[model samples]
Target: MKRIISQCSKELSQFKRDRLTLALAFLLPLITLFIFGFAIRLEAKNIPLVIQDYDRSPISQRYVAKLFATNQFIFVPWSVNDSVEIALDRAIAKAGIIIPPEFSRRIAAGNIADVQVLVDGTDSNNARVIKNSIKATTNDFMQSEGLIPETNLLTTRSRLWFNPARQESLYIVPGVYAVVLWIFPSLLSAIAMVREKERQTILQVYASSMTSTELILGKGLAYLIVSLGIALVVMGIGAIVFRLSFAGDPTPLLVAIPIYLWASVMFGTMLGTRTTNQNAAVQGVALVGFLTALLLSGFIYPLSNIPFPLSLLPNVIPARYFIEITRDAYVRGTGWIGVWFAELMIFAIGMFFFNVARRVLSKMQLTE
Candidate 1:
């Protein structure tokens, strides 16, 4: 016990002495949280809309007013001589509405009036939202003006579950926590071990009376505690800055975080043993662990949306499972029954990596 404590103390002291590592351990998570939180928003607002009204009628003006009433679009003035294509080409407007000549006359005669809508498809997501808003606004105008009967052909109401307001921050903040834990703990541990190897200090440990198991535990435990503190800081930032809510029981999340951190530390330790230098260790952790978590861990995209063999790839990514566990605990508020399987999977993976790293250390000790 004394030897393990000494090892833990030694690693902590080393971490404190290294200014770069200490900054990364504490500041990286906060920086990542702020960047992703403020920058990546899904909701579309204030889309630029240009109108070419050839009709110049009261009805045409009313239609334009109704569309702008939704606050989803801002009207950009267009003259009859100005071309719609020019506005789109110059990026002055995302969409253009053209009310053809005799529009009010055609409506009065009970004949279909043609309206042309030109949309810039460069950003498909924003274009889709703008199209839907226009459709809803037109429908409301038709109903209010007695152009359409009050009785609808099909009336539909949607009830959103879990996140009723559908705020992007609600979905993103929890995933950011997964990303922070995935990157920092692994990077810190990998650099620590590789630095020791580079300095030839690992030889002293190999010759010491302390077993390989104690060495691994002592080093891992220290980082694990530091990582947990980082996680709490991230969660607090999310709650305070983004107004993220913990809707469900937080027990599963509390339990799963350390388990994920264990897997991360062991994975880093294994990479450290394979690499010859701290640079290689950092590169390996970033390419193998951080990028995998960022892209494939169901963070930015849905697993179901990704097809066949690609969808199956996330099964091997530990962050995918941790992200699921986090969402279940913080967003859905599920109990152990909901998250036990994911928790077990993380534990199994952690144990596998931990044992592999222990074996490598044991071999190193024997050979030295």
Candidate 2:
């Protein structure tokens, strides 16, 4: 215990004096948190739309007004002679609406009025949003104008449950916490280990009275403490900047935060043991930690969308489980019963990381 504390104190003392490392530990993470929080948006908005109105009638004008009123579409000026095809081909507009000359006349004649909507299919997801928005606007126009039959057989009284306002930040920022926390702590710890090798101080540690387990635990503890500080500052800023509030019990997050950070530190330590230089250590953590947390963890995209075989990787990923815990606390609010398994997974992965790092160190001692 005394040796472990001594090692931890040495790490913290060294860490405190290094300005660049301090900035790396604190500054870079805040920057990353803000960048990911404000920048990444899944829901499409402000679609550029071109409109060709041939009817010049009151009803046709009303329909056009309805489309512009919503936050969905912004108008792109189109000449009387120019076709919507030209705008689409130029990539100027993502969608185009053509109201035929007989638009109002067809309604009066009891015929179905077709409003042709041309959407750019370059991005399949954006194209789908444009199509759905146009369809929904048309349906709303018919209902408001008494064009559709008032009678309905079955309808969904649908309500957006957790996020009624559909604010993208609410869904995005919490996940940003997971990614930011995972990347920085691991990188910091990994670099700390590799730095010893670069400075040749690791030779003294190899010949020291400290066992592999003691040395690993002491270093891991120091970084874990630093990570907690990072977590608080980053998450507090996220709460203020994004206007995030807990929807359910906060207990799950409290329990999971330390476990997740320890796992991240341990994982970095493992990479540090495997690599001889700081550059190699950083690349290893970025490739393994950043890539998995960002892509495979369902932070931006759904895990289901990830193809099979690769999908199996998330089961062992600490960030994958931590994100589940965070999103649950901030968005879903399901509490311990809902996310207990995820927290357990984080703890299990952390142990696995610590074991790998210890065994590697023990092997190194024997080899030396």
Candidate 3:
């Protein structure tokens, strides 16, 4: 017990002394959190809209006025020669609203009126939002003017389940858990173990009375505690700055986080065991762990959209499972039953990496 405590204390002291690791563990994550939290916006607002009203009627003018009155769209100047396609192609407008000469005539005769909407489909999400906003606005105008009878229309009062306001920050901020979990612990463990090899101190540890399991645990525990502290700080930032809510029971998060941290630490220990150089360890952590988490963990992009063979790659990535668990816990407010499979998978992966690292260290000790 005393030896394990000493080993833990030694690792903590060494971590404090190494300025680079300290910065990587603490500072880099906070900077990234701020950047992603404040800068990345998913909601489309104030879209440039081009209006072509051939109908010189009061009704057409009223419709145009209603559309421009909302914050969702800004009317851009349009000329008679400028076609909807031309306006969209030239990037002068995201969407073009064309009112025909018969728009008021058809409405006055109690007949259906058609309005042409030309939208740039380059960005699908933005296009969808624009279309929905236009549909809602038009419906509201029609209802108010008695153009569309309330009895004839079926209204859907859409209650957004998890995020009521449909704020993008709510969707994004919770993902910080997966990002921080991937970067900090892995980098810290990799650098710490590789530093030992670089300084030829690993030999001294192997020769000491401390068993390999004790050595691994002592180092792993120190980083695990630090990583949890970082996670708490990040959660606070998410709650305070981004207004992220934790509506669910925290039991799943509490259960999953330590296991996920262990998996990351074990994976890092494996990387450090395989590589003898600190530069190579750092690079490996960046390429294998950090980049993989960022790209394939379903953090920024949906896994379904990724093409086959490549899509299967995320199954092996620990961050992928952890991100799902986080979203389930933080966003959907799902309980242990919802996340139990992912927790089991994380534990399995952690044990696999821990065994591999143990074997590699044992082999290295024998060679020495």
Winner by TM-score? 2
lDDT of 2 by residue, 82-177 (tens): 999999999999999998999989989999888888999999988998888888988998899898788888776888888889888877888889
- What digit string (tens of lDDT, one per residue) describes model 3 on residues 44-83? 8889999999997998999998998888899899896778
- Spell out the clash pairs found in candidate 3: none
Best by lDDT: 2
User: What shift in Å separates residue 329 of candidate 3 from its native position after superposition?
Assistant: 3.3
Q: In model 3, where do residues sit more than 4 Å from their true spots?
A: 153-157
lDDT of 3 at 35: 87
Question: For residues 36-153, what per-residue lDDT tens digits would candidate 1 score against the true structure?
Answer: 8788776788889999999989999999889888888898987779999899999999999999999999999999988889899999878898888888888888888899977879
Stretches > 4 Å off in candidate 2 = none
Looking at model 2, residue 113 earns an lDDT score of 86
Query: Clash number for model 2?
Result: 0
TM of each candidate vs. truth? 0.92, 0.98, 0.89
Kindly report which residue stretches of model 1 are placed more than 4 angstroms away from their true locations once superposed.
Answer: none
Q: Model 1: which ten-residue window has the lowest total lDDT?
A: 326-335
TM-score attained by model 2: 0.98
